[model samples]
Target chain A: MSASVPTTRLQATADAFLTRFAGIKASLPGDKSLRERAAATVRSKGLPGPREEAWRYTQLRPLTDVTFETPLHADVDAQALLGRLPEIAAPHLVFVDGRFRADLSTASSMVRTGAPSFGSGARPDFDPMVALNTMLAEDGVAISVPHDVDGGTIVLASLATGQNGRAIAFHPRHSVNLADGAKLTLIEIGLGDGVYFHNPVVTVSVAHGASLTHLRLQTESEQAFVLSTVYADVASDGTYDSFQLATGGRLARAEIHATLSGPNAIAHLNAAQLLAGSQHADFTTIVSHDAPNCASRQTVKTVLTGKSRGVFQGKIEVARAAQKTDGYQMNQALLLSPDAEMDSKPQLEIYADDVKCSHGATVGELDAEQLFYLRSRGVPEAEARAMLVRAFLDEALEAITHEAGRAAMETAIAHWWDRQA
Target chain B: MLEIKGLEASIGDKQILRGIDLVVPSGEVHAVMGPNGAGKSTLGYVLSGRAGYEATAGLATFNGADLLDIEPEERAALGLFLAFQYPVELPGVGNANFLRTALNALRRARGEAEMDAPGFLKLARAEMKRLSMPDDMLKRNVNVGFSGGEKKRNEVLQMAILRPKLAILDETDSGLDIDALRIVADGVNALRGPDFSALVITHYQRLLEYIVPDRVHVLVSGRIIRSGGPELALELEANGYAGMVADAA
Candidate 1:
């Protein structure tokens, strides 16, 4: 299970998987050059290794140990998967088993006009998953909000189905562009049942003076494996607020990389992870302040029960020239059972002279006195514990601005707690 | 309504209450005053079923039922409330929400319907107004950033909302100004009825002026030494527990 084995295995798997991409890659109706270049760059990079800072907390051994071919264009009924989540009303883009299903997706009339365009820039040397996704990923959903557009939200649902014994792997690529002065809320839900692996890469670009609030809900099955990456670039005077609620998946790791590339850019990253049984969840984030007068805040809260484990590692870096930068990070975890464990590391790397950077981490159990107080008030023992757990997670949930999105996340959390109970 | 006979309790093998006997009947306010380290708070905690106090030998009964075998919430459901001396500050839990939850929990336990949001709000507002507490206190986190008098007022607010049959005020009058003390006293006075009983644990007799007790007992070294009327509190306040301890010895 060494790191090099996964990298080498993934490289060979990618080479074999590229044969099935010939048809999908040739059918590029809009931009062939960008697709070809992206594919070439990905073939060269392969998959990411442990040396990469973004992939440090997560090990891809579980995903790469078994060679997986690009899943066929399987027949999937997304309506069956989406039981009651329609309450999150928005333009729905459904991707089943790594391929976009236009028939299962919502009506085109719900699609907003003036969609922002996406460009595939020069690929980097590292980040093999980004390269692999760029080279082999099928047609993904592109959502854009033009400059000054309002009153619209796009929901992207990626669902995977495992019908056979062979492990199914899906790489979903999404690019979101927010025009200057535009405001949009995006809700991305990664949900699947059965035993499968899903690797999703989402790129968000916020134009000058625009604001984008992204909510990622990861509630996959206990037998499923998920590795999600969110890459965001904030422009001058723009705001980016991202939140993640992870309560499912046997082993789920979410990486959020936000770069404040313009002056006066603001970024808020918050995540809440609730896991029980043998579930494992890792929330790793990196916030980079590249320009002056930028501000970033990150807070991660986790609650672990049974034999579950929670990991949170947050890093805030302020560049040398990023003067007057304000960055703060905090990660707190609560372990409910004796066998439960949590690991948290909050780090700050500040090279700017006039920057205010501070980070803190705490890992412990529920306060005994608080539990006693709640129990003394006639709340049942189990109900009191749940209330305390909910209160512990409320800090991160409060950071979500969208009322409907927050309510949806809370309901998901409650459902998970009910299952545990 | 409550009886403790031959009660002996300890913490980590060190007996705090060697042997205690007391009785608080219905429609009476009994004040237990003593010097520091006299186990005043321990008595209140033990009576209300707090943990960490091992009852080596005790026989406590409340309304003809054995109280020692019940859990804290069960005791609370049976109409027992202990106003903490140092009320814990629960961050992120709103004061209004906590009170409503506690009240509704008790109600449901007693086979009563839960209070609606509007009804709960109206009752909370009236109680807050009666206590002279600011309206904003209801919206803030429970006891977080609250001053001493504010915490005391919060306890009184809970008393008003829950309306337990037996209220144990463990040093409730310690950190309060005269005006705040009068408000708390008025809250307790309003709840006074033929079926209600209270055990007030305090040091000074100053609070007795507002909420006079029918009987005052002097607890020295975990045992009640003397019992008399309200005049006993005044006498102890003037002479202090030193003379009383010497006389008992």
Candidate 2:
């Protein structure tokens, strides 16, 4: 178990147990060459480990203990498992069991094919997950927006069915490039049931003056395992806002790496994790301010109950040239049961004196006065507690602007509370 | 409407309310004027069934039902309301939503029809106007970032909406300005009726002038030492609780 070893015994076991994706990677109709290149890159470089600062808080021991394989192309009626995802009405790219299903995917008139432009060749040195995803991902959905395009949304859904016996790994790559002055809303939902594993990676690049809203909803089953990574790059004057709602899986980790590469660019990263029973969820993020005047804000909230555990590690770095950069980070956790535990670390590495940077972490229980007030108002004790918990969580959910997507997350939270009750 | 016989309560090991006896009939307002640490707030909290107030001894009955064994929410459903002296501010819970939820909970407990949204809005609007609370308070989180007067007014607003049979005003007048005090008193007076009984806990007699309690009792050293008509409040105001407690001693 050397730190630099790329492939673990578990990953080898997983590879041996499952079948590779059999879809026609060439006939995907959008950026076929780019998909092949990214897949080749990820295959060359395997998963990163604790040596990588971004993956420090979350240990991959649990994932490496079990042998997983590329999931077989199994029959999973998405309608039967999810019971009709509230009609998204926008362009949708659906992947079931790691393979794209064209019949199930509906692309809007706005979806068009074009050469991937943002960061196509300009590669950063530090992020290993990006390299791993680029090298190993078999195929992905590529969405291109023409310069100055505005007001359209794209959704990518990776769904899994537990009927497969062995552990499964899925690398659903997504390359979204926003042209100058173009605005887009992108939502990625990773959902599954039964016993399985999912490794999903999405990369987004915003052009100069472009604005993008990216949201992720991870609500897999308690028996499932997931490791997801999102990479974002913002150009000059571009704005990127991303929110993640993680409330499922036996062991789940969401890693986000964002780079403000241009002056005056802004990024808002927010996430909320609700864990109960023996569940474990982690949100690890890093924001690198490489350009002067760029700004970044990150906030994460975790609520742990039963014997569950949660981890949040956020790092914000301001380079010497990133003068006047404003960076803020806050992580708060609420432990409802004594057995529950939460670990939060907020880090700031600054190389510039003129930059404004601050970080905070808080872990505690539900406010007793708030609880008493709710219960005294006649709400049942359980419902009152749930309402307060929902309120505590609303600060994070409010960041998701998509009506359908936000509603889905809310439903997931409500269902979790109901199950606890 | 409410009766307490030899009520004994403690917090941890220290007894706060020892052998407390009180009775409030329908349509009556009883003002308990006490010196600092006289267990005035303790009595209010004990009646409302707040946790941490261990009732080691005594019987409390509200509307002919045993109150000690019930939970705080059950007490609220039984028409017992405690207007907190320092109301807790809830950041995301809207004031109107809190009121509506509380009202519906009490309604459901009493087998009454729940107030629809429109009806609730109308009632809330009228109550806010009566208390001079801005309509915007409905949109704000419950007492969050509110000034002292606004928090007190919010409590009075709850009293108006819940219409509890036994309303305990716990130091509701402590931090209010003259204008806010008048508004709060007006809200309480508006809720006064033959079916409503109130226990006003205050240090000074200033608020009593506005609501005009029917009786005033002097509470000192966790015991009521003197009982008299409304005039007793003015006397206590003129002489202060020190003189009254010294005279009683």
Candidate 3:
């Protein structure tokens, strides 16, 4: 009976989402046939539950309790939310409740709005969340960089304003394509207030000799639920560098699927999750090396205080032809309180021999000696602990190379520490 | 002034400091020389409010305030400093930032204005120069990957910057060469004045040759068995602690 509880609730949630798709299918502004197929898939499979091996550590039971409504087209004064964005000097494309707001955005020539970009990189059939996004995506951007062009920095921000105490949910489908020898730095930000569900799916394609630096900052409302999925495909001599700093959301998960389809491709998936109270966050990544001599690296750090829990699941897959693959992964968690918990799973499936693959995970409280040393230097206990926690996350945070992006991340981390202290 | 009366401390049922009594006046530097396992380091830990070393019975006062009842940071703000024997490494905390934070914390406690970053950096560089520390030392993480001598020098640098009224140096001269020893001694000597006092704990008489102490106390098995002038360190160097233990018995 206990096992059947989640199953029944999961079916109800799926039915609700399907019903939502049916109401908005005529106006969702995408491939109608594709949306129909995705809705059919959701109707059959339902939402992924605890029974699924991929989501075993992070239970979706809490999301089932909230009745999420379709976000109404209400006029939201985004001035306050705009001020909370990082002080970067780039043009921005702002989306209010997952629909593009041209008045709030600083227009960029390379970006296109008003149409959902259903790219070929994401597999809606394989992942249930991506399928849900396919069924209901209303507004997104299509960004393309020409060959050999250095398309500086651009900000993509999504703000959810749950109006009148109503729980709302939004799915934004986005796509990015970097031509050969092109470069782009994309800073994606998620911020909101009140109870809402923010589900976004992004598909990225990096052509030969191109590079894409993707930095994501997720600081949604404490009462919000965020589950985002990203699929990236890299060609020969291309690079996809990403760092996700997740410090918000009552229940959040970010899953990334990166595939290196050409030789000499590189992918770096670095993240830091700072959580407190009853917040639960999961960062899962799968790096597939399909070509010879490709390299992949991941470093995920989690700082959990109070009764919060963090999860990290990283898998490195090397195909038979992908010899000399250099893959490394490390997940570390710093549990401040005795009740805080962490779950880490590192899997490596290497069909090729002669590959250099290694992974490590460590979970510990702050070192007593380190704490004493700082306190003895006249720093108070709380400040000392915050400093030590920052130090513990330095390795993972250092992977972010963009100056403004790094500064924004530091500010977010400082705010997180401020709340904890 | 710092005074300890009938101090008895134990580490998990194993007594280390038994009925110890000592005092360092406002303008004096004293030395506590003891052999291995004689509780020299334990005394420092117990006074600095480190965890896991319990004071079963004692009354330690600093300037008429109860020291044992306060937290470590409070004691530090009260102008009490302890130079650790083995400095713990903070891998991601820069030395300059650590020093400024400590200084600002102390300043806030004392109701003084906080120093600006430029002002603090200038002051830190001057002290580091006095200790022969490179400018880049401030940029590196605190005590991480530092050589033994460099670690000792950093402790002295911290002492020089903090300028505490009373400092307890716990085996600071243990791993120093002659040159480093002189530098450390000079750093301490620069702060010696009517308002400054220190308790320099050491095992050998070598450090005393540079920074001569006003008084020397020989600790045997947890109790101070003998007390004398600077010559006591040399006497112990000649006769060894075995003779002093036998004499005390």
TM-score of chain B of each: 0.98, 0.97, 0.99
Choose the strongest candidate by DockQ: 3
Name the regions of candidate 2 deviating beyond 4 angstroms: A1-54, A82-84, A109-132
lDDT of 3 by residue, B26-144 (tens): 99999999999999999998888899876899899999999998899999999999999999999989999999999999999889999999999999999999999999999999999
Span of ten consecutive residues with least summed lDDT in model 3 chain A? A70-79
Model 2 lDDT on a 0 to 1 scale: 0.80
> Interface RMSD of candidate 1?
1.2
Lowest-lDDT window of 10 residues in candidate 1 chain A? Answer: A113-122
Candidate 3 — which residues are off by over 4 angstroms?
none
| Predicted structure with the largest lDDT when compared to the true one | 3
Sort the predicted structures by DockQ, highest score first: 3, 2, 1
- Per-candidate DockQ values are 0.63, 0.65, 0.86
lDDT of each: 0.81, 0.80, 0.93
Candidate 1, lDDT over the whole model: 0.81
Model 1 CA lDDT for position B208: 90
TM-scores for all candidates?
0.93, 0.92, 0.98
How close to the true structure is residue B187 of candidate 2, measured as C-alpha lDDT?
89
A178-255: candidate 1 lDDT, tens digit per residue: 889988888888777777778777788898999999988888878788877778999999999999999878889887
